[model samples]
Target: MSTRKDSLKFTMTSRALKLLGQNLYARPWSAVSELVANGIDAGATTIYVSMTEDPATNTGTLEVLDNGSGMTEEDLEHYVSIGFDKRAVTGTLKSSRAPMGRKGIGKLAALYLSNEYYIHTKTAPKAGKQFDSSWHMQLDFMTDADKEPTLREINATTIPTIHLNEQFNKQDSGTLITIPEIELKGLGTQAFKSLASRLAIHFLKDVLPDLKIYFSHQKINEDPRFKEVEWHPAYGNFLLLSTTKSHTYVQDKIKRKVLIQSASRKDSTTVETSITPTPSFPLNDFENADIANHISTSHNSNTISGAYFPDPLSTQTYPYDLKGWLALHATIKTTLAQDNDSTFTKNQFFSPTQIRLYVRGKLALEDLRPYLNLTEQYANYLEGELQFDLLDEDDLPDIATTSRESFDTEDPRFTTLCILVRDWAQILINERSRIAQREKERLVKITANANNAYAKRLSQSIQKLSESKKRPEEVIQEVHLGLTDNDPLEPDAHTAAKEEYRIFISHSSSNKPIADIIYDMLIELGALPEEIFYSSKDTVSTDKTKQFKMLEKQIRETITDAATKICYITSKGFCSSVYCCFEGGAGWATRAVSDYELITTTYAHKPDWLDAGLQTTSIIDQTGTFTLNRETYMLFTQTINRLVEHLNVGRRIKQEPLINSILEDKIPSDYKLRTRKEKISDYYNPILADMITHAGKSDHSAEV
Candidate 1:
């Protein structure tokens, strides 16, 4: 032990072999796609994937047959050799098709999918050779606790011949891989269709347009049916943003015609069921053109090229170029019943809504969201496919992880791509925010108009009721009429005791019903009509300039007067109105010069600005029903008492009677009131309220 040997030998146990076989892939589709990539690397033009399910055993058989340049005897040995790099043998793929597979361990995907599988293969016929031989082999990863098993121990047997399909026999060579006991639970038609769609995405359509994939499914005792899963990219009402403005997708007011293909198999005869040209909207006609325009302007020129220092200490730099289209989806939901396409449909298990990155036509990263670590507002609505083949170029160092799911994020090449994607995502988010703001403003304007109409009706109803000496019995059926506004003693007949303090009613025109209730309650409690500045009656001029002048003069005089009491009626409508905001700002200024007693309609309708520091009496809730409880009634009484003490005025009517009348009779009889049990402790924070009330009093005294 004192002197180590010149070189130490490394060995892998049987348990390590099993671990590599079983835990190589994270998803079922990913493992399956690896097999597909192998076929593509072999220069396959047509591939067929067939799956059979047995519901009883929760297992099935899966077979992948491809008319590709099949493997030779030497190639078979290389496949079983774990961790063998095929790149060392062949620099590039046949026909210059970019090889999607490098690490020869793609065979682990088949091992992970099934306990045992069979592979039958034959190479392309020689120039003069008439009879060609096919090979058949069975393999499994057997783990033993005591002994380690090596891949070299596996054996293969020679067969007379193997036929791929009706078109390809001994003369034409291909490969057929069959997994007899694949442990796949609930494998059916839908699962196969989903796999086909995902494979199309894994191997993009643009890169492999010549490749056609067909899927067939079978149950325990049923005939197998096949469907040609066409490669279709799903996008509806989308705008294409690229590194170049001259791209076809970026053209304005152009309709794109895409071929919609479907295939059905009837007894080995494949029929093209439908082939239609479905037109899609262009940039100018896009529903979300404003957002698309911003994305376009953000990219003045369309090229994304950067140089990165691969070695931090070295002066040499390597240049990389990125090509892809980033598309923003206006709506993920299907707009029409006819628009329901399987590739476009999203389910709990699968969703096409992801930003996929491809390296040499093989999916390197499933989604860029995880790589970028984005939590943007509309991050989910963005989907794209980017290609950065330089990362996989032969001259560059192999940077892809073992699983091939992602690259080394610390790499300068990947980091440069991340920065560009993040910038594009930010542009989409910024535009979405702008569109949201415009929609909010439009909704606010519509609400203001509706509220103004309602306020006018409420004003008319009050005027008509005041014109007649209607008794309580006469107006018992009317839910709007209450004792405060329609008591035996009329408001004009019984004079309110003169008081120095004035009440300012701040509310939106739509909230007049609640505001009128507060106004009548104040009048019944001895606040004179002159001492209250309610814009409804105070600003009665029809001319716009006169009405503005009347509102301005009344608000300035009442709010500046030291001893003015304020009643604010806050609601959604109130917050939307510019006039109400101005009034609220003026009322808030009065707290420094006057000991203002503030009362709000309800806690739910309380504006966010007033939530932190302001102290007010919040009585009713949003539904026009009273928050009837001991805590609320006590808070209301205390606020009114403070106002009465400060103003030195006599109560024309008791506070309890007016509050009870408003709670019991002002709202509709069906609007039942309940005691809110939860958060009742928060309803009455009298210590905090008293502090704020006294703070304003000290400010008033100092001002005087």
Candidate 2:
């Protein structure tokens, strides 16, 4: 047998190492988070993330120091190794904090922030030892790039120096990572401020109670925006929606699934496992048990299991342990209105109207307005946060994007959450609409009460006018037929009054003779000329002369205005005139046909297009004469008077009542009128008889 030393070694390409440095972290803040996570994994109770920048040179250095169970020389070797699993060997630290660093790639995160980084660590001393073993190692990407670096080459090349000096006693147990040359030059005071906020939100629960995080020697709580992160209750403002009597929803013990892997002699397989119902216990107990079993099992025959249980306090069923409150702005309108001058206008991300989502106390997503698909009106009235711990469960597949900026929409869990959000948003929208309707009804009732009181006051004024020897018509005008300025009927009464007109007359210029007669009649009946819009009289030309185009425009406006009545004078000329037809059509289009009437004379012939149901009055008989001679004039005057009354004009003239009495006397009590066709037949019968007598005489003379 050949005596040869053969040892297993892991190696990686130089390109792979370079890629790791470049792609391990997306943003400088994410790199910082990785460092913080590492400290948390190390059971750090307090972590300091400090930055020193020289604006003159645009250079900066970042250092993260954690007071935790740090690393030994052997631990330092494992830390530098790529793809090494930290939890597999050490498990959770003594502080019982869950390990945040799993893949051991968090160390490479520092490389993304700088080309060079150094680590100094001192492990906790064993029993009977006065001092701990301190170790320091430096990683230079610049030097590593120059060689064909391998995992073994890189790890073996660096030998951490053991510090035996008194300086080692300064820190009991902790680790410090220093990046002397930050590659990202954009990180300045503002950037660090933003980073501090991000840290406070991401480690919202982790950094509280025992763990304290600081930036540039200032605690996160010192920042005004993040001050709440320190004192913020575990459910901060979440339960306030209920006490405030706002619209809210809370669901817990939602069903969720996680993928489990099992290995058999033939092949390994994966299966979806749901939480099994069990007695209430700490969630960490399940996670720790699963992780411990996973680590100890053989690679070829490993198995994993999951547990599920309903929260006894949960009131609603959901897909995950979701608990939150959605508050409507209407419920807290008074409070929000007070801050309207300051807070309402600003489009900040953390506005109260926004929805925040947290996974295990870490804000996984903020401002979920886009996903909620709420209208601007409804969205502004909503605000709340929901906490779902299943999203942060270690064994569950990562649904969050690489940058952790948002959750992956493609993830089933995230998609389900979005669906729930959409449902809640719809519910809130309907509720808000219902509340608004109630408010509208309340205002209407108040207005109605005021209107009744106003009407009573107006009635007293009208009675006074009647008692003052005013004419009946004058007293009617004082009565005010509809709502007035102080009527308290509608809020827009003045605007509605402005659009009102008395009459819109649709007549042809060829029929102007008759139309003018009617116009004069209306004026005689106490109708104002301004109120009666006969296009020929009302419209003025742009050229200071009456033009048809200008007349058409004026006619359109007059017809569109709110009018008491639209009268169409139907004559032979009226039926043939295109402008007359257009005016009539416009009247019907602008207002209902019931508001208009048709007046026919002997010269008028009903058009085929005219509806038979139209109320029409004939002023002349088929002989082109007044129907009952002088009685026709009285009937026409009364018809015009009735129209004037409908126009709400305040006066009526006493128009010769004796003439109406005489016309009624002339009509025989037992007489019945013949139809138009029968009368025409009777008139032609005598003439036809005479023609027949003359024809017979002429024929006899011809025969002789």
Candidate 3:
């Protein structure tokens, strides 16, 4: 639409257009993720992102180009058109069960990253003769807001064939997406490298040996970089089920079996089973009082200890000695169509991740396996990708999000998939345990039993476990849960973690006041003190060298031998003392040995001495555990009643209307740690903020 004045004319608002251009990409990360996805979708082995800044102007540019199947002119027009609404009204759309386009909206995500971008591309030999050798398209919406975007054929003859400043390269027939608009701050090479590394750890994996991913200018060969996750000798060889190439992942309920899609589609003798065993280890361990605590109380109110693996060791490959499950490493899906929308970021996983349950080279759970998405239960660790055959000929909507990093959870297949996975979760924990046990026995025989007697015993104990219907083994998946700082601002989060958690606390004597307070608070909430792992001054002897070893020995004996959840407390003493840091060091060292979670929190505004409880509370919250507080605890315990119900009833934690009632009010945040008045702070202060901002519950509670 255009309007013209007889004597007056309006210049095209280039500035408005520029703003639109700059804001085109919703998030910078999304833009980069999109480029990476394109490569994966095109079968690129190595994806490199080169980030550099020109110090003189301080204006920076990030270049992310890939060696995937380059698009032709036709693909550019049909798939990259602006404001395309091919799938907005039509719920998730999947056809042939293998396509990955959100009709076409995923491309505009690039516009949101920066105002200006240059797209360079090349085509494969199959359809090459029609297009230019290498064409460039530059668009900057932020600088010129009102003008229609201009696209023209560009000559790349004079440009650098090789990007020297970026020191990057491209494959013979690939695409290059250069983002020339870094408005806020120019990222350093290190930041880009780190992101690239994290992505590789996630999307690019060891499980699918055929699939390959590269970061930086360097290639990622199998080495220290992509090591398997080690659960230590204590956890036994957590082997990666290299179920051979014959294993086919099937999700009959998710889509439908398309006999025509497979050259071999015969039904097998694969048996379906249930996962009914409660994991060998209890969450809070209320069942047994004889166990010792490895970590200590937080010494603060509001939050409990978190799960953290010690450093160095925490990051090491799976300690099983036997090759860990690569399939579990960064959840991999061999079928590209089965992946989330390729139009969005290429290598991102969607939430409510589900795992595929396979048995005897066949999928036991037709669709879902590992993740339990009762959405009712508020399961967040439920993230993963199921790799199976395309025997099911079903139409699936694009599995990618707007940015294309993950799947479109709203799709109907998602729920159907969940039902399928739930069945597998039921089966694996029950019948499969027998099979896993058999495999373990065979593996044990292969080891010749010299020094791993303890591992053998642990596996034996696991095999002998009594069956509980929850089927804990089904919870296993290859998803990495990363939580940044809690938005001290988010409304009360779901504390459903209550049913499925094993916590470990670590602290020092200087903060005992706060630690004890935090410990009591957690205990009231159902956490056993022994699981708290209390440590004091005498625990660390004057012998400095022995400090690390001593701490390791005690903790290893407790956490490794006992816990599933781990948390670390940071007080002034812990932060100031080299011994304490070394104790922290020991925690990091043993992550390869024991899967202990390490989370640190300290008081934000309180004084160093008086705020001991505050500091302890801060660290617990930092670990990112969903929290509950004193008032809620009493009400919760009262509602459920009988410690026996909470401890052994085996029923899932039933959330009530009162649970939502906790939303408006802080559970009395004014009290100090450990005191009867203070125990109300087990929350990450979320409910507190909620009361203040929305209902003033904290202040009104004092009046009541």
Candidate 4:
């Protein structure tokens, strides 16, 4: 049962072809990146990516145009030949730019993008000629698996298309590839801008200084405009590590053995000898250097913590150069908006936390975090970009896996690089911790001084108000006027009315679920459960007699005490319930002194019987399952921030859990809340502003 020699050859199936491209580039962004790389390899000085979306169909066409040394018909043939090594066949690329393509299979990214696409190209003229010919071709792959061609048939295929010589002058040489009818979403202005940033992070701009990339996206009728993408490395308290510098890790590992040199006469104690301790670039060296420099320079904030020029790492085994810097971000919460800077928005598409590794100026590994054991404290804040060109050295066997997403860990050079990187990362983490401790101490001193000044103003205001001997209303008004204009601690008073505060959560029994959520949220924001007066909480007394007494006592004390913050969760159940009305009326009376907050869960007009103060406060409607869009998220976070400030919870609040608990679908931010002045005037302004002495106001009569 032996097969014929002709039939013994390997066959290429259609499913295999499709799966090859799909597996190689699982993400659309990766396939697009490969296309850009091909353009760069062609010595293109400028690459333009233009995307046009059709909202009705939820699809788009992508066009990548590069002013590169375009391919000739012969070159086009080589491009179609999968796995053909152009470097081996034609020698080094003609341009000075390093070729970013290697396996020659990068062209498959085109197929991965779409089954049928158009390629418009024109070759550069010969030295003596003014112009060269231009060509156009359209390649269509069989989408149906049954119609696939054999390997020999695929090789025998010829290009079929139209000529576009009239579209350009002979001097213009470039390539434009168009991928039509691809599914796309989130191509709006901001998302497109983020795409530009994402593309910039994929390649090193310094290495390809002459290569300019512009990206743009537009709807069908809109005009296309492109914006250049630039890379801005976020470095904070960073150490610039260089392979050229002398350091211990690059030195050969020492093998030591102890040998007995002498024995004591009385106790027979043996004296041992060993090799001198292995040389190292210890953390102490950096600390000492930094201290000496900081002392001489008078604590300059701009100074770099440290810099080390190590001898080429992995020298004893496989010598390789490492060039790049590692830094600790100011905060580990990547989703936080840094002063409205869009760059820090916790980009799922391209996170800035990982160390990107580039080989021969092309991305070999998107992130090195997975390859290294970086479990040290504050390791999540570690970010860097490293270059290890040796990994892609022409002389070495290809160490990159088939997908080119990462390198072979089994390779000795890769393992050595990992060890060196892990050590350096640990160094960065330790150094960050040291700097953070110093910063924390400084902030503590500053906060203490501020708090002392604030407390002094408060004591003076209280004394003056007591001695005035005016009517209660008149004295309260005067104190409010004085503190509102002059108190530096006013903001803190506003943030948390008291260091120790209590919250009275009033809601109808029917709205218990919403009340429970609010209760847990308040607890999460730093309010102790015991200090929060939620009637339904299990800890509260359930006996009818004790419950009335407790509620009556809470209402009586809260009306007169500034330490109690009242939150009224109003709904249909609340408006109709007699007990809810009692709580609301009690909370209303406290408006003159107590800090009261209102939340409405219905769209209907609030009852006119509600206190005017609660009516003026911003209304937060729970129209759905408390989902947060960008705008709603902002509103919710701002609300939580205010609540925390008023309570003076000692811990910083994290919005992640709250934000993650709800759906984050994009929604219009048209839902507006009242301005701070309008919302706070009725309660926060009159009571809080005058409770402390303001620093700069000579006239207490000024309206806050």
Residue 82 in model 3: shift from native, Å? 4.2
Better of 2 and 4 by lDDT: 4
Give the higher-lDDT candidate: 3 or 4.
4
lDDT of 3 by residue, 267-352 (tens): 11112221122122232431122211311222222122212121323342211011111111111222322232121122332221
**Range of the 10 consecutive residues with the lowest summed lDDT in candidate 1:** 262-271
Clashes of each: 2, 4, 92, 17
Task: Give the winner by lDDT.
Answer: 1
Lowest summed lDDT across 10 adjacent residues in model 2 is found at 653-662
Q: Candidate 4, TM-score vs. the true structure? A: 0.54
Candidate 2 CA-lDDT value: 0.50
Q: Which residue pairs does candidate 2 place in steric collision?
A: 275-307, 275-308, 276-307, 276-308
Taking all chains together, each candidate's TM-score versus the true structure is 0.54, 0.43, 0.36, 0.54
Query: Candidate 2: where is the Cα deviation over 4 Å?
Result: 1-18, 21-26, 87-94, 128-143, 146-170, 183-190, 206-208, 217-320, 323-356, 360-363, 366-385, 392-412, 420-704
Cα RMSDs, all models: 24.0, 27.3, 27.3, 19.9
lDDT of 4 by residue, 410-489 (tens): 66556545655676677667765665565456445534543443355356555666554546555444334222322223
Over the stretch 1-704, how does candidate 2's per-residue lDDT look in tens digits?
Answer: 99886887657655566577667655677778778878877778777776656565666666677887887656666776776765567543435755555455767777677655666666776785533333333344556644555322233124321221123236688877666656545554556656666666556453245777766623222322212223222221121122111112122211122111111111111122121111222334324334322111112211111223223244332234445545444322333332222222212222445676766555566667787556646566566556656555565555665445477665545544554455555555665565456545644553454355336635665666644555655443333323222222335544212113357777766555456655666665456676677866644545534465766776655544333466777776677777777777665554234335566653246655555666566654454432223334444444555566545421111111111111112332222324322332232223222332232232111111
